[model samples]
Target chain A: MRAGERAYQALRADIVEWRLLPGQVLGEVELSERLGISRTPVREALSRLTADGLTEPHSGRGVVVATISAEDVRSLYEFRDSLDCRAAELAARRGDPEVFRALAGELLEALEGLTSDDDPDHASYYELVQRMDAAIDEAAANPFLRQAQTGVRLHLARVRKLSKSDPRRLASAAVEHQRIAQAIADGDPALAIATTRVHLSNALQHALNTKELAPVRPAAS
Target chain B: MRAGERAYQALRADIVEWRLLPGQVLGEVELSERLGISRTPVREALSRLTADGLTEPHSGRGVVVATISAEDVRSLYEFRDSLDCRAAELAARRGDPEVFRALAGELLEALEGLTSDDDPDHASYYELVQRMDAAIDEAAANPFLRQAQTGVRLHLARVRKLSKSDPRRLASAAVEHQRIAQAIADGDPALAIATTRVHLSNALQHALNTKELAPVRPAAS
Candidate 1:
């Protein structure tokens, strides 16, 4: 990979996975030293991060990693509640029942595997959830709403990654996804909305209670 | 922040609010003199404003405030629907029944006063709506949603201000607000969502069809 691209990916991963925390100053000098890259590449990386909204300009201090505050999580989920519920409702109205029916089945099977197996790999489960999201977005069919979903989901991924991986959440989310998929497949917008809201509230609580957020933002980092 | 950013924010707000009209020249020396700052900071401010889409570079001159067109209105309203509907639904679910019920009552009474009187003062009616907004924000209890509202409403206020005032919207909005407040007061989230959606769409149509939006964003003003 190009030096800039390599630096950008490393910095982005560090930030996303919480090794590089919110409000941590991304000084070009320190980053170049730490990443073993030149300042030009580091600058490029920082610029990319800023564009991603993962970092922001600090007064005279250069750029600092953008925060996903407790309030931000709550606010994001609140926004997600709006976006996801509408998507689910539209899915119920216009989605292919078979597509959602299949997702519902996969979600149930994923839940069983998630709860019973010792395997910690959740990639498949998460992928299944993404598929369901894609299905819902496709069903929603409104270009405007779809565009909003894309933006919301991007923020959500960043926020969600800050959480300590709890196996418990994966199991609960499996059940929630199953219910939402089933509701959509059943062509029940109200039910889909109810299920989606329940999931969002639970997710918000999970995000708020995440160990990473418990201390709130780091004071001196 | 720095003098540059402060200048940028002030200039941006003035443009957004139309205090600085589109096509208005933003000469660095003039702004610096007005803001009691140096030209460098003013230049920095103008450059940042250009990047932010709040202003644009003029040939052989400095930046000027950006213009709004029909496309801008459409885009803003589309985004608003997603936000407002979610806020209304959340208010219905979490708001105190008495508060929204009282808002509903006030709206009805305001409608009577508004239509019955020859008086043109809409301050009372607008204040009532703002009170409802505050009540809804409080009930929703999501700081994130509330914050989003603050920004979006700023944009909305700016957009609405540019419009030629029509008396018809007030009477129509009163009925809509009453329905929405009553729905929330009755703890009917779906009804609140439906009513909020209806209001946004109607508002969008009114904004689009209004002649003010067409000729207001003048070229070479």
Candidate 2:
């Protein structure tokens, strides 16, 4: 991979995972020194991040990580519903039935494995979700739609890190994925869209409740 | 505006208006000389265009304008329907009704101005359409959706230039915009979405027919 692309991916991951917190200043020199790269790549990465809305140019402060508010979260989910539901519907119409059927089976197994509350299995679960997202993007076969979904998902990933994962929500989310997978496997566009809507609504409600319980900070320390 | 931004906008407009046709090579030296700018700003503009999917890198060929096939146009419309319909629905739910009502009135006036077959009033009509799009984006009030729409519209603008304008289609398109504006003014989300669907369907049909009648070619000369 190119140095600039590598820097971009690493910085994006850090931002999404909250390692690089909101409102944090992203100086090209500082980032380049820390990442062991030249300033040019760091500058390139920051420009891409700005385009992604993960960071913005600030007066007298260069570029800083973008801050999210409660209203931002609300608007984000509303936008997600529009793109994701449509993606699900398209996947149902054009996806490989066998691939989705297999995904449905794996989701069921993942749900069963989530019985132990102590072990969240979050990593594996998120991996499954990523795989499902890739499948849907491939199945939809629209580069424009795929690009839009990717842009939304970047912010969504950052927002997801804002809330602590609840075991109950995780289990329910797995079930929701299963239903979505089954609907796509069956080539039922309406059912896929409906299920996607339900999943997003539940996820949004959970995020809102969690945010109210534990307010986010800028992570200055 | 910064030199890079000025270059980016100028190049983007040229590409969208078909002055810089698909498959054309975009050498930095050539564009910089033509635009009376430095190679630095031209490079920045090229990168931005690549991000917008207007130009792509070719091995041993440098960067070239991306081509649009018939299938590409079809997929573009399909993707537009998903995002645009959702945007219209959100505009109806959250937009200023007075703004849309006034827009509906303007669209009606524009329709009247299109009576002569020879006098298409294409430029003014497109400007009005752009105004409506901006209004809907502002009314939707979702930055993520707005960003997605902006990205999609970049490509949509390029694809639009592929077809020759028809006066009859232009008149009907104005009426369709009026219906959408009226629905948004009435705060009817479902109606707005439905009207947007009809408009997209008709527009796609027209584009397809036009493409079949007159094929697009890269402006090598």
Candidate 3:
């Protein structure tokens, strides 16, 4: 991969992981030195970030990490609720049963470990989600739908990052995934969609609660 | 607004309305003269278009107006269905009842004026959708949802422009809006979402069918 591409990927990961929290200054010279790249590649990476909505362009000079408000979370769920339901519906109808079965097995294995964990943070389930996302992508049957999912998923990542660690919630979420996978395996499109919607609504409500309890973002300086 | 802004707006409108078909070359000099602007503003406008995903950068110079493919259409709808549903749900839960009632009134008025020979074509209906969207925006209390709606609506413009023109479809659509408005007005969140989903599914199916029937892009020269 090119130097610019590497910087872009690294910066994206940092943003998604909340390591570069909202409104963090992204000085080109500092980032170039940190990533061992020249200012040119860092500049290109920032441009890409601006395009992705992860960074806001400064007054013709630099960029800052984008901010997310409570309103952003609400809106993100609204998009997620609708898109996930439709994706589940299509996945149930179009996805390969064998692939779903394999995903279910993997998900079940992950859940088995998480269920025993007294405290499982977002990191524990990250890989499991990638598997689920791959399954959803394959089942969606429409490239446009997949692209839309990408945008929603980005927003969801922020929401998930702030959510409090709750074993009960993790268990319930895993169960919900199992139900959705079962519905897909059965070719029950309506059931799959409905199950997915319920799961998302509950998750969204949990996220909202987490936001309420967490310290509010200090107003932008 | 500068000349470049004017050119961008005019070109965007033309493209959205299918007045300028896909693969149209956007020559900077010609567009500059047409909009009474210098090439600098035109170039700036093109840069913005590249960011907006409405135009693609060329290998050497200039840009191509965006053209949608079957794949693009499907992906667009997947995202749109999710965003629209979320809009409907939020509109029901948080939007003012009066807003929905007013939307109902406008839709009915439009319905009353409809004539068998006066079917609303894609362009006209596209304008009409703006009114419907205004209602959704007013109802959705979140800015993120609103911004997401804008993205989905723009992409939907292409698929919508391709849908077959039938008085029946228009009348049916108006009726769907009436039901959706009623659900929102009544504070029936589930009903509002369900009705909106039905409306979108029908519209998407219609659009997909029309797109499939439309002649394939003439063999790229």
Candidate 4:
């Protein structure tokens, strides 16, 4: 990639990973210095971030990362419930079972890998979500739906960053994903949609309830 | 509003209302002169538009107005279906019938106010939709749902602008809104959501079929 494109991608990844927390100001000069690029490229990258709703222009605050409040988290879930559930429903109706099976296998493996005791698994979990997302996107057959999903996924990333280390949540999510995949493979759109909703509702509640890093699964699991 | 804000709002209105066609290149100097503002303010306004996904920066082509395609419209409807249906479901779970009843009465009155001979009732129709949207937003209690709705509404504005001239479509929409209001007022969220989905699907299809003016529905309604 070109220097500008590389800088943009790196910045975007940081934002998505929540390494750049909400309400953090981004200075073009500073970013350019850090990325060893020019201000023009940094400015371009910031502009793209603004379009993605990850950053906003503040007259006094310069360009600050968009913050997510508890209310915002709730709001994100409400929309996620809508978009994700719809994707699940469509996946069941029009998707191939082979896709569901493949996604499920990948998701299960990712969950297993994250169940390790040594390092933090946020990056791996995020990647697993991308793979699952790719599966859903392929099944959805709608570009607009994919765009909406992308927006939702960004917000969920914020929630995930906030609710990191919660092993119970990850375990539950894996089981719920299994349910969703099975339903989709069985061509039960209603069931798949409903299962996805349940999963999101649980995740939202967990995000509201916890803040520190917790395990990917609980003692019981 | 300040000159810059005024220019921004005016240009946005024109774009959303379909007065400005897609893929139209906007010159900063020309717009500033037309709006009787300095180029600085126009540039700021364009930056804001770029952030809003209404414009894009082309490396060699200068900044051009973003265009919507048939695929964009289809994806938009799919997103809308997921969201509106979920909102309806939530409304069924949380909304008070008395609130929707009053809103339904107002919607009916507004629909009746449109004169059959008035071919350019697009502006009026847009106004009515805003009021209807207030009702929907109220019924769908999820904040995330509202935000998703906003994003979807922006895209739908282009679709509506493409199809707004069809009085038959408008009339059909009027009937659909009534049904939706009734469904919500009757405390049946599923029915309310389902009816709303039908309305959105039909409207999207109509937009895809027509060419002259893209029907721009009111942002909320």
Question: Using DockQ as the measure, which candidate wins?
Answer: 2
Docking class of 4: medium
List ranges where model 1 is wrong by over 4 Å: A1-10, A32-75, A96-102, A105-119, A142-155, A162-172, A201-212, A215-221, B1-79, B89-139, B150-164, B178-198, B208-221
Candidate rank order under lDDT: 2, 1, 3, 4
**Residues B143-162, model 1: lDDT tens digits:** 65665566567657767877
State interface RMSD in Å for all models: 4.6, 1.1, 3.3, 2.8
Q: In model 4, which runs have C-alpha deviations exceeding 4 angstroms?
A: A1-67, A111-125, A212-221, B1-7, B27-51, B56-60, B92-98, B115-125, B139-141, B209-221
**Number of the candidate with higher lDDT, 3 or 4:** 3
Error of 3 at A134 (Å): 1.4
Per-residue error for B28 in candidate 1, Å, reads 16
In terms of lDDT, the best-performing candidate is 2
Q: Better model by lDDT, 2 or 3?
A: 2
lDDT of all predictions: 0.80, 0.88, 0.75, 0.74
Q: Which has the higher lDDT value, candidate number 1 or candidate number 2?
A: 2
TM-score of each: 0.64, 0.94, 0.77, 0.78
* Docking quality class, candidate 1: acceptable
Off by over 4 Å in 3: A1-7, A25-48, A56-63, A115-125, A163-172, A205-221, B1-11, B19-79, B116-128, B162-172, B201-221
Ranking by TM-score: 2, 4, 3, 1
In terms of docking quality, model 2 is medium
DockQ comparisons of all candidates to the true complex: 0.27, 0.79, 0.44, 0.56
Clashes in model 3: which pairs? A83-B82, A144-B75, A144-B76, A145-B75
Q: Candidate 2: TM-score?
A: 0.94
